[model samples]
Target chain A: MTTEKINNISVTTLANVYFDGKCISYGITYADGSKKSVGVILPASLTFSTGAPEIMECVGGACDYKLPGSDNWVRSEAGEKFSIPGNAKFDIRVAQGFAAYHYICHFG
Target chain B: MTTEKINNISVTTLANVYFDGKCISYGITYADGSKKSVGVILPASLTFSTGAPEIMECVGGACDYKLPGSDNWVRSEAGEKFSIPGNAKFDIRVAQGFAAYHYICHFG
Candidate 1:
């Protein structure tokens, strides 16, 4: 995960309005209108829908995931990244039992 | 954790220059003189010396730690923050077995 902080950029948090306690993410915006989010996903299987093209970067633990139209689940580990197109959905499962998946979601 | 990004700041990465593969942290500098870092610590018992005051915020997992002169270990969970004085050495241990410790380090 990238840890560089720019001088002019501010960090904003996102409210957890959906999925209650299972998932949480915060939103960040760049000066040029680019946006990013960092959040944690607890152990569970979930399907997520995205409205914008998103690049998800695993920052802490590994997660097993199956993208839209795929039946095979692939594992994504820390320091790795994957992309999902806008209007698409993804199936993600965190099977590490006690390990919560930490990630950064970048909007394109 | 705050996830909002400002428009003017740039993200930079830090080279892992020490401790081999046990611990890793990335340095992020604000537009001002302030700096921050986000990293993950694998399971281990380590003692570290710091040159500046640091506010360590837990982001993903829990850690068992004994600061400076204390003999007792305390548990710090995700979303909690702890502070260490400059030039102080503290002992940190991660016993979660598989859960890596993720954190944000703020300099003062």
Candidate 2:
């Protein structure tokens, strides 16, 4: 099921704007100090590198993602998730007229 | 002082995209069921109509706003705020090449 909301957490008021505002995210912290980010990627093809391992959980909309070392592009829709290893890079894209991809990024 | 973060709240995972993605916001709910939103407005001039009264609190960046019936534009920066009455309209603009306006919207 889609995680429509995250309850009882702290949210950073400022946003992280990437790719000239094509992607925006707000940092969130849980009671136990675990960090996550809720973000949206507009219709654009973008490459990203990760420092920590990341689990991208789709909360709304969808995107096609290309994982490291894989030529295959996979679709992740609402309620679905995909993982990326630490110190790796990946590609994510939304079609020009498609809706933005809204996701929760869990970091470890 | 600026509110860098809001603790012990619930955040909606899906984002609200406005002006063709020029503005994006995330809804947040407090324990008492109070609703607020954290948002960023890219460098654009936009007119907005309000249903409920709204207080725009700057968390980062800045904007020049013109309230209803006002011919003058007023600048509001981080740590500043502006209020608009219900059933009213207002104009806000961030200059081109300037940073996006980041704010918390309190509605009543």
Candidate 2, residue B1: Cα displacement in angstroms equals: 1.9
Q: After superposition, how far is residue B27 of candidate 2 from its true place, in Å?
A: 0.6
Query: Which pairs of residues have clashing backbones in candidate 1?
Result: A6-B9, A7-B31, A9-B6, A10-B6, A12-B4, A28-B4, A28-B5, A29-B5, A30-B7, A31-B7
Q: Highest DockQ: give the candidate number.
A: 2
Model 2 TM-score relative to the real fold: 0.99
lDDT of 2 at B18: 96
Clashing pairs in 2: none
Residue B26 alpha-carbon offset, candidate 2, angstroms? 0.6
Q: For candidate 2, lDDT tens digit of each residue in B1-108?
A: 999999999999999999989899999999999999999999999999899999999999999999999999999999999999999999999999999999999999
What lDDT score is found at residue A96 in candidate 2?
Answer: 96
lDDT per residue for candidate 2 within A1-108, as digits (tens), equals 999999999999999999999999999999999999999999999999999999999998999999999999999999999999999999999999999999999998
Cα lDDT of model 1 by residue, A1-108, tens digit? 443333444444222323533565545566666667666666778899999988888877678888888899998877888888899999888874557666778887
Task: State in Å the error of residue B103, model 2.
Answer: 0.2
